[model samples]
Target: MLRRVREGLHRWPAVARLVAIAALLLVAAAAHLAARSEPAGRWLPLLVVAVVGALVAGAPRHRWPLPAIWLVATVLAVTRGSAVDPGATAAALGVGAVALVAALTADVVPVLRTRHRRGER
Candidate 1:
């Protein structure tokens, strides 16, 4: 089941990229909404979103940027609020983790497929 899904994603790079972008946007939006009361919180998520968007749009061939972006976004989202609510933090982290996994899977699927094609597995 998992292999099928992975293969499907690898078969459709554009769809996988879209899915990852959507997930990242959702995480960024959630973070923004959660901390909208603060001035810094308002712009920070936007900045992160722009950066992530640019990286995704500009370097579709690169895989390292997504993980790095995920790390930075997670840290910023989790630590932005003055008083960190455990529940909210946990939720954000969970969603961010999902986004990370999705991004990594999308990035790795092609490489794995190539290796398999070459009988390198």
Candidate 2:
């Protein structure tokens, strides 16, 4: 599934890919900024997003990290204004888990697929 999705987008024109990624990041940034200004806006996540976005979308080198970036940015956008209550904590943990899975899948699945393809050859 991952490979299929990657293969589908892999051939897209670079402008189209950049537009898609920019749209995603712009939406996330708008949401992030719309929330009541908080001093706790984590730079680390934004940094990760920039680096991953560059690697996946800017360079046309990978596809998995883009989804992880989207997941993280979306979750963070949705939860930006919330306090550290129990419910929010639980939700945060869940989002983190999903993002972790996304990142891992993006990084590992391609390697496995390549190895499998090589073995078949």
Candidate 3:
């Protein structure tokens, strides 16, 4: 299933990535709105930032460290806030896990570099 998803996205290149990023942003917005009781104005910017970071790091040429930095910063900000609702836990966990995996290895960077190099040739 995961392989199929990856392959399907790979078939369309930038379009697929853009759609995926947009969907991720939508999800973030929805999650933020649903999970937190605070004013939308407060968390909307953070949601936007998260989406922007995800989009920037969505490409094959982007290093995992870039996204990792964004994720770390976001997590710190979220935690520092006075209240954290349980509903946002899924997004936090999922993205956090991805960032952790990226931080622990050079997998994403090397794969992207190789693909980029091949494309250049």
Candidate 4:
């Protein structure tokens, strides 16, 4: 069973990446909601940061960064933003900005590497 799951992930890495990101987003959303009325709610934004960071770190090498960024941004906006109340708006925006910056970095790093390689030739 474990071997089959690993093989499936290897065969469809992009799908696996999307699913992983989606799962993280869901966890973040749930954390945001659960902590909303608690004293620990202030710390929930960190969870958002962690989720976006994980997504960026695990971004697929061969896929465009836009889809993952878009999914995270949209999910954060809907789940962490005003849908819950004004309280979550700040966390949503902050996390969204982080995700955007990470996306830019993901796109830029490969291009820079390719350019450097060509220059060496």
The model with the greatest TM-score is 1
Q: Rank the candidates by lDDT, best first.
A: 1, 3, 4, 2
Residue-by-residue lDDT tens digits, candidate 2, 31-53: 34333233335533554555544
Kindly report which residue pairs in candidate 1 clash with one another. Answer: none
Q: What ranges in model 2 sit over 4 Å off? A: 1-14, 30-63, 70-86, 116-121
Candidate 4 TM-score versus the reference? 0.45
Residues 37-88 of candidate 1 have per-residue lDDT tens digits of 3455664566466445544444446554554555555567566755666665
Clashes of 3: 0
- Report the C-alpha displacement of residue 6, candidate 4, in angstroms: 4.1
Q: Which tens-of-lDDT digit does each residue in 1-121 have in candidate 3?
A: 6456556667877866675466455545544453444566765676566555444434424445444544554455466574766546446556656865775566667678889999998
TM-score of 3: 0.33
**lDDT tens readout by residue for model 4, 3-121:** 56545666886876765666456545544453343344554564555455445444444333433444455455456445444455455445556766776687789899999999999
lDDT of each: 0.59, 0.53, 0.55, 0.54
RMSD of each: 9.7, 9.3, 9.4, 6.5
**Winner of 1 and 3 under TM-score:** 1
Residue 4 accuracy (lDDT) in model 4: 61
Indicate whether candidate 3 or candidate 4 has the larger lDDT.
3
In model 3, which runs have C-alpha deviations exceeding 4 angstroms? Answer: 1-60, 99-121
